[model samples]
Target chain A: MTSRRIESFVGHGALILGALIALYPFVSIVRHALGPAAGSNAAGPFTLENFTRAWVGGGFSHSLVSSAIVAVGVVVVTGAIASLAGYAMAMLDVPWRGAIMGVLLIGLVLPAEARIVPLYDMFEGWGLLNTYWAIILPQIASSFSLSTMWMTTYYSALPKELTESAAVDGANSWKAFTRIVFPLGSSALATLSCLIFLYTWNEFLLALVLLPQNPAVQTAPLSLSFFAGAERNTQPEVIAAAAVLVALPVVIAYAFLQRRFIQGLTEGAVKG
Target chain B: MSLGHRDVAAPEKRRVAGRALRSRPATRRAHRLRTTAWLYLLPGFAFYGAFSLWPLIETFQYSFYKWDGITAAKWVGLKNYIKIFTSEDALSTFAHAFTFILFYAAIPVVVGLVIVGVMTRVRIRLLGLLRTVLFIPQILAMVVVAVAWRWIYAESGPINAALEAIGLDSWTRAWLGDFKTALPAVGLIGTWVMYGLCMVLFIGGSQKIPRDLYEAAKLDGAGPFQEFMAVTLPGLRGEISVALILTVTAALRNFDIVWNTTSGGPGNATLIPSYLIFEGAFVTRQVGYAAAASVVLTTLILLLTGGIQALLRQRK
Candidate 1:
């Protein structure tokens, strides 16, 4: 009994220690963000001045909204497309399932770097360069592969009887999907939506390449990168504040949907 | 196009067997089913095909040519591929990427295993909350992570301040700045970001392992270490493979972290192929060379991940 108690004590100790290490950087950054800047006349240890300064100085007013637009667009479109495809693959006897699955598997393994150059040229040719479409479209494509795979995995596990009964009740495939499978898969959809939202929200490479000319369409991270590069040495606090602002939306979303986010991540890992 | 039609028709024809003229309504239903399935796939395939698949093919084609983004192309078969192998800078990017695999994948797996090993022996409270907090880092923008870590590793950053307070002043230096420490410092950031994912994955996978195995091992007089080896390690194979695939890919495709933190600098110390491709294609106008590097990098990623999947093929 004593040995068991010691083991439990050590286990909790190790977890607490690991948690502290995991959270230390975020805590330090947040503290730095709150503290008064160099040579600033703030009566207290904390100030909102850094956030205000970072917000205006970093142009996050434009970038954050821009990121939101792109993320929402990608999430909605990718979700719709993936659910349809996943439903078809899982329920209907889709011809060429193997081939389409092959392409998606390739997309899963294929890094973004492979397609960025040609995508840039294609977008340029289509006169969509520096537009939200440029960023949103490619991201949808990339996210769709995983989203379809995820939804397919989800729908496959669902009992066939759900659709079989609907078919006997004179429902076509589309009706069966809309009325039954789609609603039934809400948890999986929520999981996928959160995953897609996070992926699109935090994306940097595509925005970096595609929207180089247009600061209006530039993402929060891109703007923050430029902000941090310029002000990193002079004012670390403000940069910290800017970093927080850039990370705020996803952080908020994660805080609220913590269970779904973790479920999507871990479940995706196991099943991927 | 015709293959799908023939496939659907073939099955229907077989069901009728001797009937040369099938029921028109039944034939129509099969056609409708095929059309619906294709329709469901079309929207996704259109975007995926145009943006992802077509560009992928074009990337391979572009690798064999010499052309700026504006100028007319010139065929330069294998020249760019040759450069990736021959150039000192190009070769080193791959080496640096592999070094990151150690920090990102191998170390994290070991750390995760150790943590699981400890936790398996005892039930800890707030496992859910702990997992949520640990996982926040993985979900954050890499740029945010890099910026935050850059501060943490700064000259007057907390790390140095703590080191000084502990009377280790000589040990403190710019972690991301020095050549010797730069790669490992950057790599350790990968470790910090990835180990939680490994732990979370391992934890989730561990729960699915039947408790009977552990109890059986204990009944057979196995110690904690022995029981873990005999039961837990083997049980988490699928999770470990997944963690490896994800982290190793993240390490190799590590552009965002490098871009925000070092820009592959202090004189090219932390350069990886993804960063090299971006710089080469967009910044330096080595479009073909960039394409070649990406092709090689993608091939390496597929080979490594596929190899992991094959080696760790999960038993039914």
Candidate 2:
């Protein structure tokens, strides 16, 4: 009883400390984002200025729209293509399933940084640099794993009878797939959509390499790079608010899809 | 070995059977099933072939030629790869990966295990809130996380202010700017970013373990340590494999945290391979060399992770 009591006390203390440590940087950033700039009276003083500056100051409003456009484009393109690939993967008697799967598995292994060189050259050749499509198109193509994995899982779990029965009732393969399989795979679609959107939004290196000088075309994360430019003259308060603003949407999205997000990430790792 | 040969042989038999389709109605029906599948498959392959496969093949070809992403190809053959293996700068990037592995994987795994061990013992309230707070970082963009931590590590920043308050002012410096401490500082931010993921995985995996195992251990008068050793740890094996694999790969291809935090600065103290690839391609215009390094890194991750997956057996 005595040892258990002691252990419980130590465990609680450690747990609280660990949680605080896990949250240390976030809470610190929040404190700075809200804090008075050196010897101010109000608790979160000097900060409508910070918020205003963060919004208009960094041209974040434009970046916000640009980010939304890129993220949405990437998500839609990835979802549609992935859904097609995934659905087809599920219906495996298709010719070149072996060849196609082999190719995609290689795609899964190819890191974005590796491809940035060739992609930059390719995009430069096409005069697509500093454009939304340059970033979004490559990202959407990279969603092979996301779509194939989700679709395969959905299709694997789906009752084959529904598809066959629909086909038996004079429905063609496309019709059966659209009406029956698509509806059933809505959750997986939503999961993959969220994944693609987050991937597009969070992608930095490619965005950096592809769109660095063109600040107007920048996504939020790419835009946030301005604050970290090692320029030596940027202020902390402005940087803090900008960081906080960029993080807000993701946190909000996460709240809505928290369960699905966790499920997708955990399950995707196992399946992938 | 014969089975391997037989497996290859069977595919030919399948093709031959496929040709005799019209003679048998059942074979014709199967052939029709195959054709329908092709229609389903057409769009996906077209997209994959146009974008993914072509570019990937081009990437391999590019690695052999010394093009500055724009100029005439020099056809450097194996020189770019040989330089990658021999260069001190390239080796430093590998060193950065191992240095990151300490904070990135080792710290998180231990912390997560401890969190799980304690959660099993305590009847904690506000557990949901606790989980959310820890997890909030993982949801945020790496750019935001990286930038935020950068400010916190500034010379006259909160970290220094806190150090002053505690009379450890002498201990503080511009952490992210300090040459010696910069790599570890950037690495610690990775710990902050990733530990939440490890926690959630551990908690999820632990809750699924039959409570009776712990209950039985309790009846055996086992302490928390013993119960955890016997029950919690074993139960968490699957999630452990997952957390390790994800974090290890993240450590290898880590771009954002180091990019945004130090930019691998204070004189290349934290220059990782991902950054090297980025610099080689974009900054230096050594696209071919970058591709070679990328191939080597990808092959390394594939081998290491495949080994881990096989050794772990956490999957069916």
Give per-model TM-scores.
Answer: 0.95, 0.89
For model 1, how does the per-residue alpha-carbon lDDT over B85-173 read when each residue is reduced to its tens digit?
A: 99999999999999999999999999889888877867768998889888978888999999999988889888999999999999999
- Superposed by TM-score, candidate 2 places the C-alpha of residue B186 at a distance from the truth, in angstroms, of 0.8
Residue B204 miss distance in model 1 (angstroms): 1.8
Q: Is the docking of candidate 1 incorrect, acceptable, medium or high quality?
A: medium
Highest lDDT: which candidate? Answer: 1
Residue pairs in collision within model 1: none
Interface RMSD of each: 4.2, 6.0
Q: Give the lowest summed-lDDT range of ten residues in model 2 chain B.
A: B1-10
Error of 2 at A166 (Å): 1.7
CAPRI class assigned to model 2: acceptable
Off by over 4 Å in 2: A1-16, A35-46, A96-102, A230-232, B1-23, B121-124, B215-226
lDDT of 1 at A21: 81
lDDT of 2 by residue, A48-124 (tens): 56656678878789888889999888777677767766776775466666676666666665677657777777788
